[model samples]
Target: MKTIAILFIAFCSTISFGQTEKESDIVINNSQQDDTYRAGETIHVNAAIQGDLVTAGGKLIINDSIYEDFTAAGGELFLNDYIADDVRVAAGRITVDAEIGDDLVVFAGEVILTENAVVHGNLKCFAGNIEIHGDVMGNLDIKGADILIDGTVKETSKIVGEDITIGSNAKFHKEVQYWSSEGQMDFKDSLVNTEAYFDEDLGEEKSELSLISLGIASFSLWIFYVLSAFLVILVLHALFKNAFSNAVEGLQNNLLKSFGYGLIYLLGIPLLIVLALVVIIGIPIGLFITTIFIFSLLFGHLIAALLLVYYYKQKKEKDWGFWNITFLALGIAIILRLLTIIPFLGILLSVIILSITYGALTLNVIHSKKQFVKT
Candidate 1:
C-alpha cells in the first residue's frame, strides 16, 4: 500500500511537472490550446489562455485571464489574472493577486493572498505560513503552521494550526471555528461575527471512526492504482506491442545485468543531480534526468509484470496472443497489488523487481537506438 502511494505521488509529480515548470516564459495573445502542458525554470505570461491551464516552474507570474481551470506547482507562483474556474496549486510560495470565479485550493510552504486577490468561492489552504489579506466570498479552510487572516470572508471558516491571528480588518460574517496549539484567543469583538470556538485538542483527537475511514481510504486508493496500471498497460500494449515484447525478452535474457545496473543507477542519480545543482549550467540536464526517473518509476512495475507474464508463458505449452495480453497483464497487476497488503516484504520485493525492470527497459531502448544508428 505504501509502495502504491509512493508511485501515485511520483506519477502526480510527473503530471505536475508537465503542467508547470515544463514551459517557461510562454506568452499567448488570444489563442487557446486544448490543454496547457508546460514546465520550465521560470514562467512569465502576459496573455490569455482558453483551456485548462497547467504549469510548473521555478517562478510563475501571470497577468492575464484563463477561460478554464488553472493548476500549477513549483517553487513560486504569482497569479495576477482572472481565472474563470477553479485554481489548484502546490508550490513553495504562492500568491494570488487576482479574482478566481471558483475555488482556490493550495498546498504550499508559504501562501499569501494579497489585498488585490478575490475568490468567489471557497478558499482552502494547506501551508507552512499563510496570510490572507484578500477577499473570499465563500467559506475558508486553512491548515498550516501559522495563519493570519485579514481578509473578508462572507461564509464560515475552519482553521487548524499552531499559531492563528486575525487582523482588525478581518471580517467573518458567519461562524468561525479554529483549533490551535497556542490557545491564545484574544481578539476584538467587532472582527468576529459570532463567538468563535477554539479547542487545543480538536483535530488531533483520534477515534475508531478515523481509523476505519483511513482503512477505507487506503483500500480505495489501492484499487484506483490497480485500475490506473491496467489502463496504462492496455494503452502501451496497443501502441507499442512489438517494442514491449522485445523489452520483455531483453529482461529475461539479461536479468542479472539489469538488476546490477538498476541498483547502481538508482544510487548514482541523486549524487549526479546534486553535483549538477552545484553547477548551474547543468540544471536543465538534471531536471530532464529527474523527469525520466519519475517516468521510469511509474512505468517500471507494469513493465515488470509484463516481463513476468512473458517469462511464465515461455515455460507453458502455448503462448498467448496480443489480444490476450491485456487480460494477462490485468491478472498480474491484481496479484501484485494484493501482495502489497502484506507487511514489508511485499513492498520490498516490488521495489527490487521494479528496479530491475527499469534497468532492462533502459538498456533495451539504448540497444534499439544504437541499432538504428548503425543501419
Candidate 2:
C-alpha cells in the first residue's frame, strides 16, 4: 500500500507542476486544447477541451466540457459541465452537476451528485459523506461513513458504509448488496426490482497476526528503499564525479543562491511541463520532463546526504578520497533515514534538504551550460 501510494504521488507530481513563483496563483483556462494540465491555488476552466483535462489545485471549478477523461486532485472541486469520458478525482469536497459519458471514480471527504447530474457509466467512490440524488445508468459501488442515495441505479449496486440511507426517491433496477456494522438495512420492496445481499464478515477488522505481518512488510520495504537509495547515490557519484564536485563547490560558494535556484527549478519546471502538455506537438517534451522530475524527487534525499558529507569535509579541512567520501555519504544517508521517522519534523527536514541539494545541482548545470556556450 505504501509503494502504491508513493507511485501515485510520483505520477500526480509529474502532471501537477504548475505556474512559477511569479505567475498568478489562480489559473483560468478559456481556450480549446488537445490535452490540458494545470496546477495552481485556484483553477477555473470555462473552455471546451478537445482531449483530456488534468489539474491539481486548492479549488477547481469546471464549467465547460471535456472530450476525453478528466482527472483532478484538489481541496474543493465543482463540475458543472460535461465529461465525454471517465472522471477520476481525489479531493476534500466534490460536487457534480454535470453529465458523465463514462465511469465516475472519486476519493473524497464529502461528495454530492446533485439532481442535475447524470452518469452514463458506473459510479465508484470512497468518501466520508456521500449524497447521490442524480441518475446513474450503470452500477454503483460506494464506501463511506455516511451515505444517502436518492438516485437511480440502473444496474447492480454495492455499498459499504457506517450509516446508509436509501431515500424514498431511490430506485434500483437490479440487485443491491450492502455491508455495515449495523447489519442489513430494510428497503422498501418498490425501491428494488431485484435481490439484496449483506455480508457481515466483510466489514470486520483484521486479526492481530495480519496487522503484525503488515508491519513487518512495511519495515522490509523501508529497508529496501534505504539500500536502493544508497546504491543509487554511489552510482551517481561514480559516474558523474566531476559534475558532482562542481555542484558541491557551487554549494560551498553560495548556499543561499543555490537554494533560490533550486526553489525555482522545483516550482518552475512543473509549470513548463504543464504548458508543454497543452500542445499536441509538445507532448513528448512534457513526458521527458516528467521522467526527469520524478528521478530528481526519488533520489533527492540521497543527493542531499552527499552534499552534507562534502560540506562537512570542507568545514573540517579534510581531504577525503573517493572511498572515504562514499562511506561518509552512506553514513549520512542512514542517519537521514532514521531522522525521517520523527513524524512532521522529519518530513520538513527532508524537504529542506532536498531543496538545498537540488538548488546546488541546478546552479551547477546552468553554469556548465554557460561555460559550454562560451567555449
Cα-lDDT of candidate 1: 0.69
Q: Give the residue spans of candidate 2 off by over 4 A.
A: 1-29, 205-375
lDDT of 1 by residue, 26-145 (tens): 555555656775555566767788889877555678888888999776666899989999998866678889999999988677888999999999998767788999999999988877
Cα error, candidate 1, residue 360 (Å): 8.4
Model 1 regions lying over 4 Å from their true place: 1-25, 33-35, 39-41, 205-258, 261-339, 353-375
**Model 1: number of backbone collisions:** 14
**Position 220, candidate 1: lDDT:** 62
Please report, in order, the local distance difference test score of every candidate based on alpha carbons.
0.69, 0.74
Could you tell me the C-alpha RMSD of candidate 2 in Å? Answer: 15.8
**How well does candidate 2 match the true structure in TM-score terms?**
0.54
